[model samples]
Target: MQRRANVELRTAYNAFIESKRMSDPASGLTEIPALNQTLKPHQHDIVTWALRRGRAAVFAGTGLGKSFMQLEWARCVAEATDMPVLILAPLAVAAQTKREGEKFGIEVKHCREQSEVGDASIVVTNYDRLQKFDLEHFAGVVLDESSILKASDGKTRTAIIEAFKDYRFRLACTATPAPNDYMELGNHAEFLGVMTQEEMLAMFFIHDGGETQKWRLKGHAESEFWKWMCSWAVMLRKPSDLGYPNDGYDLPPLAIEQITVGVDHDRAQDTLFVMQAATLQDRIKERRETVEERCRAAVEIIARKPDTPWLVWCNLNSEAELMTKLIADAVEVRGSDKVEDKERKLLGFTDGQIRVMTTKPSVAGFGMNWQHCADMVFVGLNDSYEQLFQAIRRCWRFGQTKPVNVYLVAAETEGAVVANLHRKEADAERMAEQMVAHMQDITVATIRGTSRTKTEYNPSVEMTIPQFLEAA
Candidate 1:
């Protein structure tokens, strides 16, 4: 009788363990046709994995063929469902994506409104134009630079997630999903319907306490969280992270130089001696006070390479105006510019018509591929490390043949800002390493069509009832 009771207990325990395993159900195609032949091995595998998962994200680094993979995914989904797949991208990227589609032999239609999307297998539109179309018509949707979902206003972000909650297929592709904040991972998770943000927090995170917004992973939940992440998303800084060769995907040498302009101590009214900017307001003041010097430094850097293409990123309109005015061949793309004007100038720069382009990182940093230009200058910077990282990547990403040089021009009083940026960058690098370490094996297994095995419960010592209980 005791032996039989032990057997029943072990069975119940195994059943409980199986029920607690974390794996998303595959709502996607079990049998996929041949994908685009142009895909690299890594790209092909990722595309296949995404199609199998139905709703997924590809957090591939910049210049790692995200465009190719996403286009192929869209094409296959469109063909499989016999319905259009809509791709929403940042401003000026729709045209670029359309061109990419053409290169890969996929016909992509660029549309602005619902009527323009008629009968197109793959439709590409800017994020701002999302409301102009009907979401119910498409079988699949792709967010090219899906990080914008977090950067956008709350209402816009919610609208996007709510609109696509029921879509049969979805893909979110971006390089920096969570640059410094892991909490942002919840955005993509929530968007994919893998879990709600609150639910994810409850499962894997604990309140870090002082601030209401702060949360950290629970100590025991790290492995399980990443395991859950691998089920629905794949992240890698390079091909080798997923056990692939890094032959053509290797990036060129990147050189970063800081140019510090002298700040006028007389401009500081609060103290007898000018000190490092300690707060956001002080940093803004320092940047504004030294804009002229910073802009001149940027102008000097670009002047040395006058014949070469230069990408200049600034923060304030004042900096943009000054840099464009000081640099003879510079074209500025401002936030207030008309959409057509922004597209024209951006494409002009891409086509080599403009030798120097001045714009805010928020304006032109997200998705532009500026490999032709190996030099860039940041005349202004905010504390947002993600923006700074993306701005530099515009010129420093893969496929650029020459060594890339980045110049950050800041005033002496703004030392703290630069230091803060460096600190955040270090944090981001550490976080990425941790992410890759935890997800590498799992991602490789998932992409290569292997299943994860849960730990089985085995009874070593024979289970025997207590003497008192047995007697009772």
Candidate 2:
């Protein structure tokens, strides 16, 4: 009986693989003559999976063309299924998706403006705006940077899942879905109807406690995990599995060095208290937000140096707002800007007309090719390794001439945290160890789920102006 059961299981698995290979054949099939010119191999894998599988995930790395894959997959599905494809993304990136379609000669129709979506094939909108639009009207849906919805209970995430529930075809794309742990995989699987968190735990996971249900590793969990993923998601690394298009071009040798900047004792203590302990108290309010002093320093760095294009990475609206003091035309690409503005900014940077472009790593990282500047300053830290690498690679790319230099700016103690990030990143190339240690906490929270802690920065280290200037 056991032998018979094994045979049946193998047969079923083979059937699933067979069914997943063929493309959809329907009356709606309309092929763009220019499709072949733009689609890359990994993108074709996603396109095929979308047409064949009922639902799937395309977990391609950043800078490896996920937006293009999502748009192209949606276009393929639209032709076969004859329904407009709805795409949800972070605001800065959602605006850029429509233009990515045009880069391949595919056009996106604006569904929100119209009373009814027509022969028009593709529609793009942000996750926040997805609620206002009727999601069921579309035949299929694609979620870009799907990790943004990992917190299962958030209004946007719930709205996204509910909206796409009835679609015949559904797909989600992000570089690192489980940047921290296994359970982050649950939401995507549930969206695809492959399994629910409850079902996945019962079938493949070892759960803890009767109430909160945290995950501990099941035996052979990693192997089983990858095998199961074969039916639903595909992940790839760049310049390893896929060769670079500009391999022939000479890239500048990158020299990464660390310089510890010293701070005044009083300022150091205040900053340190603000970063570490001040947040623990009620009366003392701690803020990591920049003051005019840092802006002045960055400006001096730019002004004193001649003709060297500098890219400054900063968080918070006010931090970027200060850059105009140094750069008369400092520009920012936030998740909120329209797609055209992003395109203009990239063109300006490429032409050296825009000297400084302050940005968040996740939004501005992937779609733009910025080989113009060989210098980068990480004014802030994001938990994901993929976002950070994508931001730095803008200059570290193949066509770069001068050796790339990356300056990661942070409070002295936080410098340890930032340095650990780069070392962890370097190891990622060898072992393909998918987990980023610090990020595991957020992923664990999603898996087990607890009320989130409120956060504030109490700078543990501080510096005086004269001391900081002399070091610089």
Candidate 3:
């Protein structure tokens, strides 16, 4: 009897895992001829990447030419597949997207109803009208300002995701897809069919609190989750992240000034000491009590340069009304305004016809490009850092030649709101840095990763059996 020797053979477990990880699940969509010559180099690259992936999300920052990228993407898909592409935009953004398309010689039909969308190569409509059109008619869909899918009214979000589920090509474009909460990313994941929101939560996250749907990723799953995200999405704050030059995209200097008004403690509180707002109701009470003071302070700042273009952001309808009346040339757009009126006034402001425009960020903040205006005033504060950032960026984005001025007008007691906003801003900045740093190289790799061809294992070395094994 002799001892037997063991022989080892290696399997392609690493190769199989790598291949499956990097493989794109999309139906291979063919690239079309260059649809737009006017696209910046980075814009061209993004469009090309979307074309290859078939379904993707471009989480580009404000003023990074997301509109241009989206338009070109729609154009490419429409041309390549010879099927119409649908673009779902925020209110007034459809018109803006149409204009962006024209610059590149791509014709975009802005539609309010299905009848208005006839025979168009690229159809642009608001998200609210998602149910109006037949989803099967279009081969591709693009969601401009895609974060709107996370709106509290989950109906629209659910409709957009389910409506476009069968479409061969899909794109979700936005500046903030997951602004503060990671759960927001679930909407994108589900919309793109990369993974269902429930599956994503189950795999990467857990119920953070005992009684809330609030999800925090499992500590060990953070890296794996981000890597999974990059397989289907690309988030870049600037072109430089994708190895493109950022020469013309540089933002001008931003000058933010805080204007504090003395609160009449007797009115807001019975005691001598005015306490800071600690809750939403308290903040609302403070805002209601001091709308006049905040607006008046904002009005004074605007009056200094009466001829200059200014954007005033208010949180309450009352604030908008007071500011519009107090400022002789101001126009206010409220939530109750007719759709036509809202579009007209927003376009009017964009065209420089309106010297001063007053509106809540909820009404006009998401998509309009107001680079023509260099001055802005925040008449009050809201808890949403996204709204605050969007409102400021309406003026402070790229293409503004002058330094942008932002005035934050708040009452003394609203210090808590202002401080909270500042804290959120800092947190957002840090999150953005982390997101970019984590995604930049990985994003480049993801794009390049998908194009990789799997290397087949071919061993040139001849293997010999062990003498003991051969004897056996």
Candidate 4:
């Protein structure tokens, strides 16, 4: 009897698995035409893969021409469905994306409000103004830098997912999502209608008992989760990952230098002796007491190279003011600045008008392209690895002609934060490798048009009904 029961359970599980695989309607989505001659081979392959899937995410690294791929995807969707597509971008990125579309002869209209949205097939607007647009007017939506959805305040993220619940075609494009941060991917899944954050967590992850108390993939479910993710999204850090040439996609070398300044902290009052900070309050105290020292170190470094373009990242308002006053011709961008003024200062730095620009990573880190500048300084270090990584990649990305130099200026008491950052960097690198490896096979299969589909299965054995419940 036990043997018979086990057999029945196995058969039921197999049937369930096969049914779920067959239920995905993405396989039936319309396949758009081939891309234009202007697109690179890799770009063409990615655009084709996305169109076929209909709702997908592309996690290509910075400077890999994500803008072109997204623009081409929008163009094809508009042409096929005969309905316009809306692109939500960061502050100044809407203008930059518009310029890129013009180069490809694709007409994209930039609008501040829905009333400004004209007859163009493609319309670009910043994410902050998403509520102003009418959802029924567009057939598809493209989210540039979609990671912003995982922000502390979940209002925007929730709004986007609810607003576009019924949209047939959706595309999310961003640089590689951080592996340590699972909520980022959860946001994407929820936005794409694949699964809710809670559902994803319950399906493939277990609660980690560490201080962070984050969710990690179950050891047994790791492979299955990645395979399932590949069914809805594609992640590639470079062109070669999908079997295309990597020419011009290589990143420049990064040189990280640490500058430690002396700060007089009364150790006896805080602790028994000088030790690494293990609490949030301790880190805050260290940072607050040593702001002057850290600023001096940053100013001295910037003074050495006054003629070159420099990007200075700071944590406190005081640091920004000090850098601007101490460094010659340095412009400061604060959070309270008007939208127009902030955009002007950022573009000025990109165009070489502002020799030095000072601001926080949270303000200008995510979507800006500043590859022209190779030198940057971090006057203060926070525990947020994502912010730090984004801040550095702004200049270290592709198309950078010079080897990027990053100076991490910290007080002696802040060694704990710096060390923690280094550890996170190493962990993030390892996680990226694992993620790419798991997705490589699926990505290759999808791009090459070789992925297999579920076929109906028929059992060979003929079963008889049990005697306990005979037909009445």
Question: Over 4 Å off in model 1, which ranges?
Answer: 1-23, 268-272, 416-418, 443-445, 448-472
Residue pairs with backbone overlap in model 3: none
Query: For model 3, what is the alpha-carbon lDDT of residue 411?
Result: 82
Model 4, CA-based lDDT: 0.81
* Consecutive 10-residue window with the lowest summed lDDT within model 4: 448-457
Question: TM-score for each prediction?
Answer: 0.90, 0.68, 0.88, 0.89
| Rank by TM-score (best first) | 1, 4, 3, 2
Model 2 lDDT-worst window of ten = 447-456
lDDT of each: 0.86, 0.59, 0.79, 0.81
Index of the highest-TM-score prediction: 1
lDDT of 3 by residue, 1-472 (tens): 3322322322343445455442336553554475577778777767777788778889988888899888888877887888899998888888888888888788999998888878898999987788788887899999888878776477767877878887778899988765457767888878877777887788788785786866777999877777677667778888887777889988889888889898876764476688777778887898898988898999899988978999999988899899989988899988888888988999999998999999998888898898889999999878787878888878787778889999899888777455677788888787677666667766444563335212223446655555766577
Model 1 lDDT per residue over 34-140, tens place: 98888988899999888887888899999999999999999989999999999999999999999998999999999999999879999999999999998889999
* Global lDDT of model 2: 0.59
Tell me the alpha-carbon RMSD of every candidate: 3.5, 16.5, 5.5, 4.0
lDDT of 4 by residue, 1-472 (tens): 7567757767876777567543335531455676878898878878888887777888888888899999999999988888899999877788778888999888999888889887889999988878889879999999998888875377778888998988888999988688778888888888887777897888789986786547889999887777777667777778776667899887888988889887665754766766655677887788887788899888889888879999999988888888888886999988788867877888888889999999998888888889889999999877789989999988988788899999999777666455677899999888777777766776455664624222224557655445452332
Worst 10 residues of 3 by lDDT: 1-10
Shift of residue 359 alpha carbon in model 1, Å: 0.7
Better of 1 and 4 by TM-score: 1
